[model samples]
Target: MAFQTTKQTISQPLLDTAASLYCSASPHPTLKSISDQLKSQGHLDITPLKVRRLLITAGVYKSELASQIQSLYDSGKTITEIMGIMHLSRTSVHSYLPYVINADDEETEEENLCQRPISLEQQKRCEQAMEQFQKDWKGESLWEVITAFAGCTFVTSKGLKFTYEVKQNRHGEPTNELVISRKEKTVTKATVIKAYEKLLELSAEDSEDGITADQAKESVPPRFPIPLSGPKKLGTFGASYLYPIFIKLGLITEYPMLSYFHLPFSDDIV
Candidate 1:
């Protein structure tokens, strides 16, 4: 058999447009946006994938941060620590690392045979479990459940384990369950409330406490303790464990302007 190769040519004008558009000061352009611009301005129709390929060929899409992430990994930083510092996911951190191979390249027939695709029934069960987990993990119902199941340990999605110690009144009836950390410290619920109050106070002012509305807008919920002294400072670990629970209970709002913090599933930290 004889083999023949055909060469595919891309016009210089198209290359120039892609380069100019990609390097522009405007926000990072998506492939779809780049394709749209090329079609409108260059009068050439192209797909987003093709635009991506052209950019890659031109060396316009550079992995500048990948090297830095790899350097951190080489310096003995854990994946969780790297994710925390870079505000990236575990998968993303792994992707940025130099030695990790692409998933497609790593896939094999044996692995495929061993791994079963999730059945519809299994998927439904998973969805229900996730839904129930979310529902039971936070809010007034969570507090109720904790009071009912005092002394039982529960784990969060992030694998943070905690339990509630039942606080009894004079009649020996359980009044409230004190959130207990893995370190055995009692977390004061009032501290979490106070942190939210501080956030509210800061958010209410136009420019007070050195926190601007824009800064508050970009802020994640405080990690707890609220930088205060005494009992508030005691539960840094415990308070963090209950922070999500407080948010669900409407005790800690994200900001004064916003009613509640809609926690993201991707948030690895509780």
Candidate 2:
């Protein structure tokens, strides 16, 4: 007569509970231990073989088992000792060891990575720029300063001049559009001051159109809109590049609703 295997019937909830217990337990309990706990506490009659099948079916057995093996190995346990504790053979232990080691190495690499340090000269130039920005800043929000500074032009090493323009949508909303142009870039504090002064000069010239300097200043806010609804808004791409400098100069204030919005943009400012 041939020997027959018995099919176990367990509920989904019971299997899920067992898996949860297995994951949460420190030094994670074995299938046999889980079965015993379920029978004692949960009052569910589950065999160790059934628990194993359930864990495997849930797709957690291999990874969880490997984690347990790795934890034991990391604690300086010998392979033979791990074999006795986890009931895994040398081949199984060897197969998972590389993954564990590689994971740790990747974590170490990430931790070691540091941000590139800003130079003292750049810091001085940034501070000078901020000083000019503050003297000319007439708008209510720091976002206005960011937009103005973003519009300031700087010449590249090859003498290619570039500047940014805050593009607005049809609804008069400022999108994340910092349109770069090859116009004469304002590289110095004097030039930035002159740029704003020139705007006021132009606004004065357009007095016949009823556009006062104050109105022109008010117009700057509309160039970078913050919706009256929803959470309090911050500046966009142009804002991110200037944030570190703003922090250094104590220009940024902490408010309940205010946050720094980081959007994708080139941080390379001349």
RMSD of each: 14.7, 23.8
| Predicted candidate 2 versus true structure: per-residue lDDT over 126-208, tens digit per residue | 45654554555542223344454454443332334455556677998875544556432222333333333433444444455
Where does candidate 2 clash, by residue pair? 153-185, 153-186
- The local distance difference test score of model 1 is 0.46
Q: Where does the lowest 10-residue lDDT sum fall in candidate 1? A: 106-115
TM-scores of the models, in the given order? 0.29, 0.21
| Candidate 2: C-alpha lDDT | 0.43
Best by lDDT: 1
Cα lDDT of model 1 by residue, 1-270, tens digit: 001121344565676788788788555677677788888885565766566545654666545465556676675444544554455655555544422223432311111100134445544543454345344332333344334334444443355656656666789876544647566555444543444444434443534457764455344442221222122322444545554443322233222221123312221111
TM-score of candidate 2 against the unseen true structure: 0.21
